[model samples]
Target: MKPSTSSFNEVKKAIVLLSGGLDSATVLAIATAQGYECHTMSFDYGQRHRSELDAAVRIAEQFHAKTHRVMQMNMNAIGGSALTDMDIAVPTGGLSETVPITYVPARNTVFLSYALALAEVVGALDIFIGVNAVDYSGYPDCRPEYIAAFETMANLATQAALEGHKVKIQTPLIHLSKAEIIQQGVALGVDYAKTVSCYQANSEGLACGQCDSCLLRKQGFREAGLDDPTPYAI
Candidate 1:
Protein backbone atom coordinates (compact mmCIF):
# COMPACT_ATOMS: atom_id res chain seq x y z
CA MET A 1 0.00 0.00 0.00
CA LYS A 2 1.27 3.44 -0.96
CA PRO A 3 1.62 5.99 1.84
CA SER A 4 -0.87 8.78 1.49
CA THR A 5 0.54 12.06 0.24
CA SER A 6 -1.15 15.36 1.05
CA SER A 7 -0.07 18.58 2.78
CA PHE A 8 1.79 16.29 5.12
CA ASN A 9 3.94 15.23 2.19
CA GLU A 10 4.81 18.79 1.24
CA VAL A 11 8.18 19.63 2.66
CA LYS A 12 9.88 22.98 2.15
CA LYS A 13 13.60 23.56 2.05
CA ALA A 14 15.30 25.55 4.83
CA ILE A 15 18.87 26.59 5.51
CA VAL A 16 19.76 25.93 9.16
CA LEU A 17 22.80 27.47 10.81
CA LEU A 18 24.07 24.58 12.90
CA SER A 19 26.81 25.34 15.44
CA GLY A 20 26.84 21.92 17.12
CA GLY A 21 25.64 23.63 20.29
CA LEU A 22 22.70 22.63 22.46
CA ASP A 23 20.38 25.32 21.13
CA SER A 24 21.25 24.71 17.50
CA ALA A 25 20.78 20.99 17.90
CA THR A 26 17.33 21.60 19.32
CA VAL A 27 16.57 24.00 16.49
CA LEU A 28 17.45 21.38 13.90
CA ALA A 29 15.17 18.87 15.57
CA ILE A 30 12.34 21.38 15.61
CA ALA A 31 12.87 22.33 11.98
CA THR A 32 13.01 18.71 10.85
CA ALA A 33 9.93 17.81 12.84
CA GLN A 34 8.16 20.72 11.16
CA GLY A 35 8.78 18.96 7.83
CA TYR A 36 11.57 21.09 6.42
CA GLU A 37 14.22 19.53 4.22
CA CYS A 38 17.00 21.14 6.26
CA HIS A 39 20.33 22.09 4.69
CA THR A 40 22.63 22.65 7.66
CA MET A 41 25.56 25.12 7.60
CA SER A 42 28.44 25.63 9.99
CA PHE A 43 31.55 27.78 9.82
CA ASP A 44 35.13 26.77 10.49
CA TYR A 45 35.90 30.37 11.32
CA GLY A 46 39.18 29.83 13.12
CA GLN A 47 37.36 29.81 16.42
CA ARG A 48 39.39 28.77 19.45
CA HIS A 49 36.74 26.19 20.24
CA ARG A 50 36.95 23.96 17.20
CA SER A 51 35.42 21.00 18.96
CA GLU A 52 31.94 22.45 18.46
CA LEU A 53 32.34 22.11 14.71
CA ASP A 54 32.95 18.41 15.10
CA ALA A 55 29.82 18.23 17.26
CA ALA A 56 27.90 20.15 14.61
CA VAL A 57 28.78 17.59 11.96
CA ARG A 58 27.64 14.78 14.24
CA ILE A 59 24.35 16.49 15.14
CA ALA A 60 23.59 17.27 11.51
CA GLU A 61 24.05 13.65 10.54
CA GLN A 62 22.04 12.43 13.50
CA PHE A 63 19.13 14.69 12.61
CA HIS A 64 19.21 13.55 8.96
CA ALA A 65 19.82 16.96 7.39
CA LYS A 66 19.39 16.84 3.63
CA THR A 67 22.83 18.46 3.33
CA HIS A 68 25.48 19.87 5.67
CA ARG A 69 28.26 22.24 4.63
CA VAL A 70 31.05 23.50 6.86
CA MET A 71 32.52 26.62 5.33
CA GLN A 72 36.04 27.85 5.97
CA MET A 73 36.61 31.48 6.86
CA ASN A 74 39.14 33.20 9.09
CA MET A 75 37.35 35.32 11.68
CA ASN A 76 40.63 35.33 13.55
CA ALA A 77 41.80 37.98 11.11
CA ILE A 78 39.01 40.30 12.24
CA GLY A 79 39.16 39.13 15.82
CA GLY A 80 37.89 41.18 18.71
CA SER A 81 36.24 38.29 20.55
CA ALA A 82 37.72 35.75 22.94
CA LEU A 83 36.33 32.91 20.86
CA THR A 84 38.43 34.03 17.89
CA ASP A 85 41.41 35.60 19.61
CA MET A 86 43.42 33.90 22.34
CA ASP A 87 44.54 37.30 23.68
CA ILE A 88 41.12 37.97 25.21
CA ALA A 89 39.95 35.54 27.85
CA VAL A 90 36.49 34.00 27.93
CA PRO A 91 34.73 35.55 30.90
CA THR A 92 33.82 33.31 33.80
CA GLY A 93 32.66 36.12 36.09
CA GLY A 94 29.08 35.63 34.89
CA LEU A 95 26.66 37.30 32.49
CA SER A 96 26.61 41.07 32.60
CA GLU A 97 24.71 44.03 31.15
CA THR A 98 27.48 44.54 28.61
CA VAL A 99 28.19 42.08 25.84
CA PRO A 100 30.80 39.55 26.89
CA ILE A 101 34.25 39.07 25.36
CA THR A 102 33.03 35.99 23.53
CA TYR A 103 30.73 38.00 21.29
CA VAL A 104 32.37 37.53 17.90
CA PRO A 105 32.10 40.86 16.10
CA ALA A 106 29.63 40.61 13.25
CA ARG A 107 29.77 36.83 13.47
CA ASN A 108 26.05 36.20 13.18
CA THR A 109 25.76 38.73 10.39
CA VAL A 110 28.47 36.98 8.43
CA PHE A 111 26.92 33.57 9.09
CA LEU A 112 23.44 34.77 8.11
CA SER A 113 24.83 36.32 4.96
CA TYR A 114 26.14 32.93 3.92
CA ALA A 115 22.82 31.35 4.85
CA LEU A 116 20.93 33.88 2.73
CA ALA A 117 23.12 33.13 -0.26
CA LEU A 118 22.56 29.42 0.15
CA ALA A 119 18.84 29.95 0.53
CA GLU A 120 18.70 31.94 -2.67
CA VAL A 121 20.62 29.39 -4.69
CA VAL A 122 18.72 26.45 -3.26
CA GLY A 123 15.28 28.07 -3.55
CA ALA A 124 14.80 27.88 0.19
CA LEU A 125 12.78 30.84 1.37
CA ASP A 126 13.36 30.15 5.03
CA ILE A 127 16.53 30.20 7.12
CA PHE A 128 16.60 28.81 10.65
CA ILE A 129 18.96 30.05 13.35
CA GLY A 130 19.23 28.90 16.96
CA VAL A 131 19.90 32.20 18.68
CA ASN A 132 18.27 32.63 22.07
CA ALA A 133 18.05 35.89 23.99
CA VAL A 134 17.40 34.22 27.30
CA ASP A 135 20.25 32.41 29.04
CA TYR A 136 22.59 33.72 26.33
CA SER A 137 25.97 35.44 26.48
CA GLY A 138 24.35 38.81 25.65
CA TYR A 139 25.70 39.10 22.12
CA PRO A 140 24.15 42.09 20.36
CA ASP A 141 23.37 39.85 17.38
CA CYS A 142 21.16 37.54 19.42
CA ARG A 143 18.61 40.21 20.17
CA PRO A 144 15.23 40.10 18.51
CA GLU A 145 15.64 43.59 17.09
CA TYR A 146 18.86 42.53 15.43
CA ILE A 147 17.24 39.48 13.90
CA ALA A 148 14.30 41.51 12.64
CA ALA A 149 16.64 44.00 11.05
CA PHE A 150 18.56 41.20 9.42
CA GLU A 151 15.38 39.67 8.08
CA THR A 152 14.39 42.99 6.56
CA MET A 153 17.80 43.36 5.00
CA ALA A 154 17.75 39.80 3.71
CA ASN A 155 14.42 40.27 1.97
CA LEU A 156 15.68 43.45 0.35
CA ALA A 157 19.03 42.00 -0.68
CA THR A 158 17.73 38.87 -2.38
CA GLN A 159 16.73 38.88 -6.05
CA ALA A 160 14.22 36.21 -5.19
CA ALA A 161 12.49 38.68 -2.92
CA LEU A 162 12.31 41.14 -5.79
CA GLU A 163 10.60 38.40 -7.76
CA GLY A 164 8.06 37.90 -4.94
CA HIS A 165 9.74 35.07 -3.03
CA LYS A 166 10.15 36.63 0.38
CA VAL A 167 12.83 35.07 2.52
CA LYS A 168 12.00 34.58 6.19
CA ILE A 169 14.60 34.28 8.93
CA GLN A 170 13.28 31.91 11.58
CA THR A 171 14.62 31.77 15.12
CA PRO A 172 12.70 29.02 16.84
CA LEU A 173 14.62 29.22 20.08
CA ILE A 174 14.80 33.00 20.29
CA HIS A 175 12.73 33.82 23.35
CA LEU A 176 12.94 30.47 25.08
CA SER A 177 15.00 30.09 28.22
CA LYS A 178 17.84 27.59 28.26
CA ALA A 179 15.88 25.21 30.43
CA GLU A 180 12.91 25.35 28.10
CA ILE A 181 15.11 24.74 25.09
CA ILE A 182 16.68 21.75 26.78
CA GLN A 183 13.34 20.31 27.81
CA GLN A 184 11.94 20.69 24.31
CA GLY A 185 15.00 19.07 22.78
CA VAL A 186 14.82 16.20 25.22
CA ALA A 187 11.20 15.64 24.29
CA LEU A 188 12.31 15.43 20.67
CA GLY A 189 14.80 12.74 21.64
CA VAL A 190 17.87 14.97 21.27
CA ASP A 191 20.96 13.45 22.85
CA TYR A 192 22.37 16.25 24.96
CA ALA A 193 25.60 14.34 25.38
CA LYS A 194 26.23 14.55 21.67
CA THR A 195 26.05 18.36 21.62
CA VAL A 196 28.88 20.62 22.82
CA SER A 197 28.24 24.25 23.87
CA CYS A 198 31.41 25.13 25.71
CA TYR A 199 33.41 28.19 24.76
CA GLN A 200 36.69 26.29 24.97
CA ALA A 201 36.05 22.61 24.65
CA ASN A 202 39.05 20.27 24.82
CA SER A 203 40.25 18.09 21.92
CA GLU A 204 38.39 15.18 23.48
CA GLY A 205 35.28 17.46 23.42
CA LEU A 206 35.10 17.89 27.19
CA ALA A 207 33.83 21.30 28.29
CA CYS A 208 36.07 23.68 30.23
CA GLY A 209 33.29 23.99 32.85
CA GLN A 210 34.40 27.50 33.81
CA CYS A 211 33.62 29.52 30.70
CA ASP A 212 30.34 31.40 30.43
CA SER A 213 29.02 28.87 27.93
CA CYS A 214 29.58 25.96 30.25
CA LEU A 215 28.17 27.80 33.22
CA LEU A 216 24.99 28.63 31.37
CA ARG A 217 24.60 25.08 30.09
CA LYS A 218 25.09 23.60 33.52
CA GLN A 219 22.62 26.04 35.00
CA GLY A 220 20.06 25.19 32.36
CA PHE A 221 20.23 21.48 32.99
CA ARG A 222 20.02 22.08 36.70
CA GLU A 223 17.00 24.31 36.33
CA ALA A 224 15.37 21.73 34.11
CA GLY A 225 15.98 19.03 36.72
CA LEU A 226 17.98 17.02 34.20
CA ASP A 227 21.40 15.57 34.68
CA ASP A 228 24.09 17.25 32.59
CA PRO A 229 25.52 14.71 30.21
CA THR A 230 28.39 16.91 29.09
CA PRO A 231 31.87 15.86 30.09
CA TYR A 232 33.81 18.59 31.83
CA ALA A 233 37.56 19.17 32.04
CA ILE A 234 37.68 20.80 35.42
Candidate 2:
Protein backbone atom coordinates (compact mmCIF):
# COMPACT_ATOMS: atom_id res chain seq x y z
CA MET A 1 0.00 0.00 0.00
CA LYS A 2 2.99 2.25 -0.40
CA PRO A 3 2.32 5.33 -2.50
CA SER A 4 4.89 7.00 -4.74
CA THR A 5 7.34 9.16 -2.84
CA SER A 6 9.22 10.87 -5.61
CA SER A 7 7.75 13.73 -7.70
CA PHE A 8 5.22 14.80 -5.15
CA ASN A 9 3.03 17.55 -6.56
CA GLU A 10 3.23 20.74 -4.59
CA VAL A 11 0.23 20.88 -2.28
CA LYS A 12 -1.87 24.00 -1.95
CA LYS A 13 -3.02 23.46 1.64
CA ALA A 14 -0.68 22.75 4.54
CA ILE A 15 -0.71 22.30 8.29
CA VAL A 16 2.35 23.53 10.20
CA LEU A 17 3.46 22.61 13.68
CA LEU A 18 3.76 26.03 15.23
CA SER A 19 5.36 25.59 18.64
CA GLY A 20 6.15 29.25 19.08
CA GLY A 21 9.80 28.31 18.46
CA LEU A 22 12.12 30.04 15.99
CA ASP A 23 12.31 27.11 13.60
CA SER A 24 8.56 26.45 13.31
CA ALA A 25 7.82 30.12 12.87
CA THR A 26 10.30 30.27 10.01
CA VAL A 27 8.83 27.15 8.44
CA LEU A 28 5.36 28.71 8.61
CA ALA A 29 6.69 31.71 6.75
CA ILE A 30 8.20 29.47 4.08
CA ALA A 31 4.90 27.62 3.67
CA THR A 32 2.93 30.84 3.34
CA ALA A 33 5.36 32.21 0.78
CA GLN A 34 4.93 29.02 -1.23
CA GLY A 35 1.24 29.97 -1.63
CA TYR A 36 -0.05 27.23 0.64
CA GLU A 37 -3.11 28.24 2.60
CA CYS A 38 -1.56 27.48 5.97
CA HIS A 39 -3.28 25.85 8.94
CA THR A 40 -1.31 25.76 12.20
CA MET A 41 -1.29 23.21 15.01
CA SER A 42 0.07 23.87 18.49
CA PHE A 43 -0.07 21.71 21.61
CA ASP A 44 -0.32 22.21 25.34
CA TYR A 45 1.81 19.16 26.04
CA GLY A 46 2.58 20.06 29.63
CA GLN A 47 5.93 21.65 28.88
CA ARG A 48 7.54 23.82 31.53
CA HIS A 49 7.06 26.96 29.49
CA ARG A 50 3.54 27.59 28.22
CA SER A 51 4.45 31.09 27.11
CA GLU A 52 5.40 29.60 23.76
CA LEU A 53 1.69 29.05 23.09
CA ASP A 54 1.22 32.81 23.08
CA ALA A 55 4.03 33.10 20.56
CA ALA A 56 2.47 30.36 18.47
CA VAL A 57 -0.84 32.21 18.36
CA ARG A 58 0.82 35.44 17.33
CA ILE A 59 2.85 33.73 14.60
CA ALA A 60 -0.23 32.00 13.26
CA GLU A 61 -2.08 35.32 13.13
CA GLN A 62 0.78 36.98 11.27
CA PHE A 63 0.64 34.33 8.57
CA HIS A 64 -3.17 34.48 8.59
CA ALA A 65 -3.19 30.71 9.00
CA LYS A 66 -6.65 29.45 8.09
CA THR A 67 -6.97 27.47 11.30
CA HIS A 68 -4.93 27.19 14.49
CA ARG A 69 -5.65 24.16 16.65
CA VAL A 70 -4.29 24.02 20.19
CA MET A 71 -4.82 20.48 21.36
CA GLN A 72 -4.05 19.21 24.86
CA MET A 73 -1.82 16.18 24.75
CA ASN A 74 -1.13 15.23 28.34
CA MET A 75 2.49 14.11 28.10
CA ASN A 76 2.73 15.25 31.68
CA ALA A 77 0.61 12.26 32.70
CA ILE A 78 3.36 9.91 31.45
CA GLY A 79 6.13 11.76 33.33
CA GLY A 80 9.39 10.56 31.74
CA SER A 81 11.06 13.50 29.98
CA ALA A 82 12.63 16.52 31.63
CA LEU A 83 9.96 18.78 30.13
CA THR A 84 7.24 16.84 31.89
CA ASP A 85 9.18 15.95 35.03
CA MET A 86 10.06 18.66 37.52
CA ASP A 87 12.93 16.75 39.23
CA ILE A 88 15.38 16.51 36.32
CA ALA A 89 17.73 19.43 35.91
CA VAL A 90 17.78 21.24 32.57
CA PRO A 91 21.15 21.02 30.76
CA THR A 92 23.32 24.13 30.66
CA GLY A 93 26.37 23.25 28.60
CA GLY A 94 26.50 23.24 24.81
CA LEU A 95 26.32 20.24 22.40
CA SER A 96 26.51 16.73 23.81
CA GLU A 97 27.39 13.33 22.36
CA THR A 98 24.03 11.78 23.17
CA VAL A 99 20.50 13.12 23.42
CA PRO A 100 19.90 15.61 26.23
CA ILE A 101 17.51 15.27 29.18
CA THR A 102 15.23 17.83 27.57
CA TYR A 103 14.34 15.49 24.70
CA VAL A 104 10.60 14.99 24.88
CA PRO A 105 9.40 11.40 24.45
CA ALA A 106 8.07 10.78 20.92
CA ARG A 107 6.86 14.36 20.80
CA ASN A 108 6.94 14.71 17.02
CA THR A 109 5.20 11.39 16.57
CA VAL A 110 2.32 12.52 18.73
CA PHE A 111 2.18 15.94 17.15
CA LEU A 112 2.19 14.51 13.65
CA SER A 113 -0.56 12.08 14.57
CA TYR A 114 -2.74 15.00 15.58
CA ALA A 115 -1.73 16.91 12.47
CA LEU A 116 -2.65 13.95 10.30
CA ALA A 117 -6.08 13.80 11.85
CA LEU A 118 -6.63 17.51 11.39
CA ALA A 119 -5.26 17.52 7.86
CA GLU A 120 -7.54 14.68 6.85
CA VAL A 121 -10.53 16.45 8.35
CA VAL A 122 -9.70 19.56 6.36
CA GLY A 123 -8.43 17.75 3.21
CA ALA A 124 -5.00 19.34 3.47
CA LEU A 125 -2.31 17.43 1.62
CA ASP A 126 0.90 18.80 3.08
CA ILE A 127 2.30 18.87 6.62
CA PHE A 128 5.09 21.20 7.68
CA ILE A 129 7.32 20.62 10.70
CA GLY A 130 10.47 22.40 11.75
CA VAL A 131 12.88 19.68 12.83
CA ASN A 132 16.57 20.52 12.37
CA ALA A 133 19.00 17.63 12.71
CA VAL A 134 22.30 19.46 12.36
CA ASP A 135 21.49 22.13 14.90
CA TYR A 136 19.53 19.99 17.35
CA SER A 137 21.64 16.89 17.98
CA GLY A 138 19.89 15.96 21.20
CA TYR A 139 16.39 15.20 19.90
CA PRO A 140 15.75 11.80 18.30
CA ASP A 141 12.73 13.07 16.35
CA CYS A 142 14.83 15.74 14.64
CA ARG A 143 16.84 13.08 12.76
CA PRO A 144 16.43 12.90 8.99
CA GLU A 145 15.81 9.17 8.83
CA TYR A 146 13.03 9.40 11.37
CA ILE A 147 11.28 12.10 9.35
CA ALA A 148 11.68 10.17 6.11
CA ALA A 149 10.22 7.12 7.75
CA PHE A 150 7.30 9.15 9.00
CA GLU A 151 6.68 10.40 5.47
CA THR A 152 6.59 6.85 4.17
CA MET A 153 4.19 5.84 6.89
CA ALA A 154 1.94 8.79 6.12
CA ASN A 155 1.64 7.79 2.46
CA LEU A 156 0.71 4.25 3.36
CA ALA A 157 -1.76 5.14 6.09
CA THR A 158 -3.65 7.93 4.40
CA GLN A 159 -6.73 7.48 2.18
CA ALA A 160 -5.87 10.61 0.20
CA ALA A 161 -2.56 9.13 -0.91
CA LEU A 162 -4.20 5.85 -1.76
CA GLU A 163 -6.68 7.72 -3.92
CA GLY A 164 -3.93 9.28 -6.13
CA HIS A 165 -3.17 12.70 -4.66
CA LYS A 166 0.22 13.10 -2.98
CA VAL A 167 0.70 13.97 0.67
CA LYS A 168 3.90 15.82 1.52
CA ILE A 169 5.75 16.35 4.76
CA GLN A 170 7.75 19.51 4.37
CA THR A 171 10.87 20.11 6.44
CA PRO A 172 12.35 23.30 5.06
CA LEU A 173 14.65 23.70 8.04
CA ILE A 174 15.86 20.12 8.19
CA HIS A 175 18.96 20.55 6.05
CA LEU A 176 19.84 23.96 7.45
CA SER A 177 21.94 24.67 10.52
CA LYS A 178 20.58 26.99 13.19
CA ALA A 179 22.53 29.88 11.71
CA GLU A 180 21.28 29.15 8.23
CA ILE A 181 17.74 28.85 9.52
CA ILE A 182 18.05 32.19 11.28
CA GLN A 183 19.42 33.76 8.11
CA GLN A 184 16.52 32.40 6.09
CA GLY A 185 14.06 33.72 8.69
CA VAL A 186 15.70 37.11 8.59
CA ALA A 187 15.43 37.17 4.81
CA LEU A 188 11.77 36.21 5.10
CA GLY A 189 11.15 39.06 7.54
CA VAL A 190 10.20 36.77 10.44
CA ASP A 191 9.78 38.65 13.67
CA TYR A 192 12.21 36.66 15.86
CA ALA A 193 11.10 38.52 18.97
CA LYS A 194 7.72 36.78 18.73
CA THR A 195 9.21 33.29 19.02
CA VAL A 196 10.04 31.64 22.35
CA SER A 197 12.74 29.00 22.87
CA CYS A 198 13.33 28.78 26.57
CA TYR A 199 12.95 25.55 28.50
CA GLN A 200 12.73 27.56 31.69
CA ALA A 201 11.28 30.94 30.74
CA ASN A 202 9.67 32.84 33.58
CA SER A 203 6.09 34.08 33.78
CA GLU A 204 7.40 37.41 32.59
CA GLY A 205 8.76 35.70 29.40
CA LEU A 206 12.44 36.03 30.36
CA ALA A 207 14.65 33.23 29.01
CA CYS A 208 16.99 31.30 31.27
CA GLY A 209 20.26 31.70 29.42
CA GLN A 210 21.67 28.48 30.94
CA CYS A 211 19.13 26.03 29.52
CA ASP A 212 19.90 24.04 26.34
CA SER A 213 17.33 26.05 24.36
CA CYS A 214 18.95 29.32 25.37
CA LEU A 215 22.45 27.98 24.69
CA LEU A 216 21.42 26.94 21.16
CA ARG A 217 19.77 30.33 20.58
CA LYS A 218 22.97 32.05 21.72
CA GLN A 219 25.03 29.93 19.33
CA GLY A 220 22.63 30.35 16.37
CA PHE A 221 22.61 34.16 16.66
CA ARG A 222 26.37 34.20 17.14
CA GLU A 223 26.89 32.02 14.08
CA ALA A 224 24.46 34.02 11.98
CA GLY A 225 25.90 37.27 13.38
CA LEU A 226 22.33 38.32 14.20
CA ASP A 227 21.11 39.72 17.47
CA ASP A 228 18.19 37.93 19.24
CA PRO A 229 15.75 40.50 20.55
CA THR A 230 13.86 38.01 22.74
CA PRO A 231 14.37 38.90 26.40
CA TYR A 232 16.94 36.88 28.34
CA ALA A 233 17.46 37.45 32.04
CA ILE A 234 21.12 36.43 32.02
Clashes per candidate, residues 3 or more apart or on different chains = 0, 0
Model 2: per-residue Cα lDDT at residue 165: 58
Query: In model 2, which runs have C-alpha deviations exceeding 4 angstroms?
Result: 1-11
The best candidate in terms of lDDT: 1
Of candidate 2, the 10-residue stretch with the lowest lDDT total is 1-10
Q: Which candidate has the top score in TM-score? A: 1
What TM-score, over all chains together, does every model reach? 0.94, 0.92
Tell me the spans in candidate 1 whose CA falls farther than 4 Å from its real position.
Answer: 1-11
| Candidate 1 local lDDT, residue 6 | 31
> What tens digits encode model 1's per-residue C-alpha lDDT throughout 143-189?
99999999999989977777677888999999999999999999998
Model 1 worst lDDT run, 10 consecutive residues:
1-10
List model 2 lDDT by residue over 34-110, tens digit each: 99989899999998878899989999998899989899978988878778888877777766788878888889999
TM-score for predicted model 2 compared with the true structure:
0.92
